[model samples]
Target chain A: MTYCVAMRVDEGLVFLSDTRTNAGVDHVSAARKMAVFEQPGDRVLVLLAAGNLALTQAVMQLLSEPAPEDKPTLYNVATMAEAARLVGDAVREVHRRDAATLAEFSVDFNCSFILGGQIRGANTRLFMIYSAGNFVESSQVSPYFQIGESKYGKPIIDRVVTPSTPLDEVAKCALVSMDSTLRSNLSVGLPLDLLVYEKDALQVTRFSTIDNDNHYFQMIHRTWGERLRQIFGEIPNPTWADPANVPLRARETVSNVPRVTGSELRAEPDTSAPPFQTLMQPESGQSQH
Target chain B: MTYCVAMRVDEGLVFLSDTRTNAGVDHVSAARKMAVFEQPGDRVLVLLAAGNLALTQAVMQLLSEPAPEDKPTLYNVATMAEAARLVGDAVREVHRRDAATLAEFSVDFNCSFILGGQIRGANTRLFMIYSAGNFVESSQVSPYFQIGESKYGKPIIDRVVTPSTPLDEVAKCALVSMDSTLRSNLSVGLPLDLLVYEKDALQVTRFSTIDNDNHYFQMIHRTWGERLRQIFGEIPNPTWADPANVPLRARETVSNVPRVTGSELRAEPDTSAPPFQTLMQPESGQSQH
Candidate 1:
């Protein structure tokens, strides 16, 4: 129902989220899902959420409330890990209060969050928190986290992103990923929230609320598809005439293509027959063979 | 898990399927999923399946057994529609025999099929049959069907394949789609079965059991990813300096990027807050204003 992705590259952190939410096909509406917490020179934190609107809003509400003097809150958390724990605690708190009532109506308590930023003393870090109030941080081998409708746009990110990727390039990749998702899935729509944080900046510098009219996103939507088609054409089609010369030749030892029982079919029928009779009837005398 | 896709184009039909099947990550094995029924100069039918391995194999077994004197079989079906109906009927029969028992074990009666080919008097047809034994035929607007782990590879097919696409190109698109799927999902693996049928041939003409050593598929596996990264690089990165010159500019009318309440934070807190308190607290004097 949503697409939110965040990357932790060597240069910085990038966060992006879509605005669309729906109860069903007919009840579609837009809601911004990116939230920023800043303390200027001290720390900067960004939270992106996906899942049930009510549950996410509830978690966000708990996170936004003033903390009791002795407790930790997003504003006073000393480290990125602590910030994530605070988010997880809020999620669990919501689950504690709302899960039972929501379960009565058959609504599963579901929500996920991407929390990424720098606290003055630490390095930029990114974490994905689950519906169950647990989380995992990004690592060198896995430099990103995506929540919601993630598969359609995943291949490209899996191919292009690494910890070494530049901040601007990572930002571009995130938008491109979002574009692919928006095209393939109707549930994720525009008016996006994109935030690019430079490592150690300790403040939000580059942020945008992109709508249908955004020129840069418009170019990506058009150019990515067109260029993809262009490259697809540029690749040579498989040549069946000479299997020996082609890369996708049929192998020698493997069995031939499977063909069902019928006149003029070459491949043998599967020896492991079913326990019951099939709809296929052999020609009069052929069964004897 | 498996990835099976079939396309219906003006030139002919293309069907591609992966061989990997798994009871769980620890019990991975390979089993061919494409089965063909051909009557040479009369008709040709191909079935590609995905879902519970036992259920699909059971349905396939029922289709392969000897038909009784009175019923229609793959050999006797007059049209492609009849062929799809026969397959659907086999699926329903399997459900009747096994669904309840499987339910006791909590295993779903989940399986789906892509059936396509041509008969002497009719045009090429493709249908996607669901677990319930109901099916829907492919149309010009949506000319392909994919079952099991399909989302990862869908965007490319959505952009490139259409009814007017040529046979070889369709085959290439299918492979590229499969390649994307293989990259993102560990459950779908190689040693793929590919079958290409030309209109009016009424028999299997081009088929390949492509393994990891298959050169053409190797070329596809390498070149596609390389060229994709190349093209991704060719697209200029978004320039943040001037929104007017770029394609991803932020719109002026929409609200500014969201910022949670905190000292030195510029953007306003969401005015329509949830009915509960948020973890965000405006600093001492800041909240009173």
Candidate 2:
């Protein structure tokens, strides 16, 4: 399991990836999942990967090699979109080679990547490339892409990112997002690779490889937890037995008191009894009269 | 898809479930995913279901009927553990009857549940019952379980929950967790059912069917998102380019930057060395010149 997130904001792009890999829980190992390809002054491409480590590694290997003259490669791609397609093609190449053999052992061809950056003349762009060698580029409306163990870290991104967001701020949010992922998932461990690219820079600007001892990340991990609890403490707890005091009217309509007495009707037991008793009445809405 | 979380804290149990069901992206409808069977003064069992809605509905129908004498039904179970097993058994019963037929049509017998509550004379407890009809109970060390579309909402709970957490606080955490899940997943929607039980009460107490219009929930929704962004803003953004100015080190000892270029040499490289040059030699212990 890994968690990789990249954002395409108006100012630039931010990419972050966790470094833990595991064949199983017992075989956990550290493996860098982010690769930076910089032909300084021309292009700076960051690739964040997740899923089967072997497959991701294979795809990375395929992409690192300069493609034959007739084939498009990230190094020579005219635009960020074309660079993303080159990544997708690399993923497909790896899949075509290994998917069948791995399937014999019940391994799904599971792997994905986030490819984002700028070519000399193009705008910074972000994309999420899939196992099938297909991809989607991020846009202003949705200025980010996440791959691998994404959900635990997504809500924050969904709430915070916009194309107009400051590049530095998005980098902070990406780290916080990664912190959340690291806490919840064991497979996504420490030693994170964080790259912050300023639009049109054509060179890596901010690149941090954070391990457990990194101060800023440590601050993020601790502060986020303490502040979350503080905020959680401020929220009101449910009013259990009181009806009139309930916070919401619809909730007050339900009483916490139990309506049934040992499966024996609490009301008139005659067959002529009101048909209302059998209706889907929540215990919260009923009180023993 | 669904998102349901149940926690067994020292004070008691908390169960929360969202109410959205989607057969596909285009076919979405709302249906409650929580079912409560409260035999007040004796037992209170809350069932939160996720996965195939039809299958869960079937299991619910089967469980709601009077239990056979030999079968340990939640209504008559001696302990919370036994009740969890009964739920598991019921899942198996449904699977035995429905799985093969569903498999014939390329459907899966995919459904799972979180069953938690207390029975008279027993301690409060929680259990996660899987589709295989096997289940695991929560312990003091790992005192909660989540089912269906769970990952997105997991980080906060992972960081905040413990057996020692107060009931009200845990309840707040569960709601916050649900909020995260709701924001990230369309499959998990509104009109949530929340139940919080007090230990040894042997009766339902704190319960609410919260919808989008509920005031308290509206407050939580608004406040949580705002607070998250505020905290996100507070965290410092990465310092790029000039590592010397940053408080934290930005490079790792076994850095991946070298690997990026190394892999390139393993493949056909540049006939023209492009503009950026990989530094050919580095003094021992130094990553940058």
Candidate 3:
């Protein structure tokens, strides 16, 4: 499993990836999942991959190979979308060559990638390519893509990031998102690769290989959780009784039933009815009435 | 899909569940997922279900029916573990009745539940039941259980809640977790059911059916994200190319990099190739080096 996220903000693109892989819990190991293609002053394409290690490596290998006469390669693609298509094509190619053999051992042909960056003549663009060789680009309405072990870290990104977000803020949000993922999932661990590319720069402006000792990330990993807990503590607890208490949600109100009494036992009955005792006793024998 | 979570803290138990259900994006609707059974003094059990709606409802119906002989029913169960087994048994019963028929329609026999509360003689307990009619009780190390659409909300809980956490803090954390889930997943929506029980109180003292208008939740939903973004704004941006950068990983002191030239582009290619980019560059030249 892996967690790779890329955001396309007005100022630039932010990409982050973790470095952990496991065939099973006992076979866990570290594997970098980021790849970069640069022609300096021309095009800067960064890819972040997730899923089966073998298949992802194969796709990367194929993309690294010189383009064959009939095949589209990432290096030769004309546009960001073309690069995305080439990535998807590579995934499909891997599927064609390995899916059946892997399936014999019950492994699905699984892998996905986030392809993003600028190509000299065009604007910075982002895409998410799936295991089935399908892809979709980011838009103003949805200016980001996340692959592999994404959900744990998604809510923060959904709330804070947008095409209008500042470059620095987007980078911060990405780190916070990765912090959350690291806390909840063992499959995503440290030594993060973070790349922030300014719009039309066509070269990496900010790139850091953040290990456990990375000061900013360490502060983030520590301070964020503490501050979150502090804020959580500040929020008022639910007012249990008092229907008229009026909470933040104005649409509905709590029912004014007597709070359950620990000592007030439910009805006891003879052999025919059976003696009863429980936390929620019926208010009365109204049903029988 | 639904998001339901339960925690067994030393202070007591906290259970929260969302109401949204959808067969597909266009088929969205709301339905309550939490059910309560209280015999006032002897026991209190709350069942929060997620997964195939019909199957979950069927299991609930079976649990509500007259107790069958030779089976451990929630009504007659002794310990929380036994109670969990009863729920599992009911699940297995439902699977036996509907799984094969559902399979013909290509529907999965998916249904899961988080059952938690007090049974007078036992301590507050929480258990998560799976589709296979197997279950695991929460322990001190991992004091909570979540079912269906869970990952989005998990990181916060992993960061904040523990058996030693106070009841009020747990309640607040649960809402925050639910807020994150709601933000990320449309399948989990409002009209949440929240029940918080105090330890040794065999009764349901605090229960609220919170809708979109609920004030406390609205405050949490609003403040958490806003505060998060604010905190994000305060974290310094990654300073590019600084050897003595405070944000750099403490263990790896890098000295060769030049300071970032603000708004100025350097025309020279990097003289020293960093190993990070070398591994990421898919080109054969970099690979051979």
Model 2 residue A98 distance off true place after TM-score fit, in angstroms: 2.3
For candidate 3, the per-residue lDDT at A42 reads 74
- Candidate whose DockQ is highest: 2
For candidate 1, write residues A1-289 as lDDT tens digits.
9999999999999999999999999999999899988777778899999999999999998888766667787888889999999999999999999999999999999999999999998999999999999999999999999999999989999999988888878888999999999999999999888888889888776776777766677878899999999999998887653222223312443636677665322234434321111111112111210
Question: How well is each residue in A1-289 modelled by candidate 3, as lDDT tens digits?
Answer: 8999999988989888998999888988988888887665677789999999999999988877654455555545678989888888889999999999999999888898999989988899999999999998899999989999899888888888888888877888898999998888888887788887889877765677777656667777888888877776776665443332323223332322222221212223212211111111122221210
lDDT of 3: 0.76
* Cα-based TM-score, every candidate: 0.89, 0.86, 0.85
**Which residue pairs in candidate 2 have backbone atoms (N, alpha carbon, C) closer than 3 angstroms, thus clashing?**
A205-B241, A206-B240, A254-A284, A254-A285, A255-A284
In model 1, the Cα lDDT at residue B211 comes to 76
List each model's interface RMSD. Answer: 11.7, 7.9, 10.5
Model 3 misplaced stretches (Cα beyond 4 Å): A68-72, A243-289, B68-72, B242-289
Between candidates 1 and 3, the lDDT winner: 1
Candidate 2 per-residue lDDT, tens place, B1-289, comes to 8899999988888888888999999999987888876765677778889999899988887776664466656566788788787788889999999999999999999999988887887777788899999988888889989888889888888877888899877877888888888887888898787877779876665666777656556777899899878877876664433333223223343333522552243244433323221111222222332
C-alpha lDDT values of all predictions: 0.83, 0.75, 0.76
lDDT of 2: 0.75
**Which candidate, 1 or 3, would have the higher TM-score against the true structure?**
1
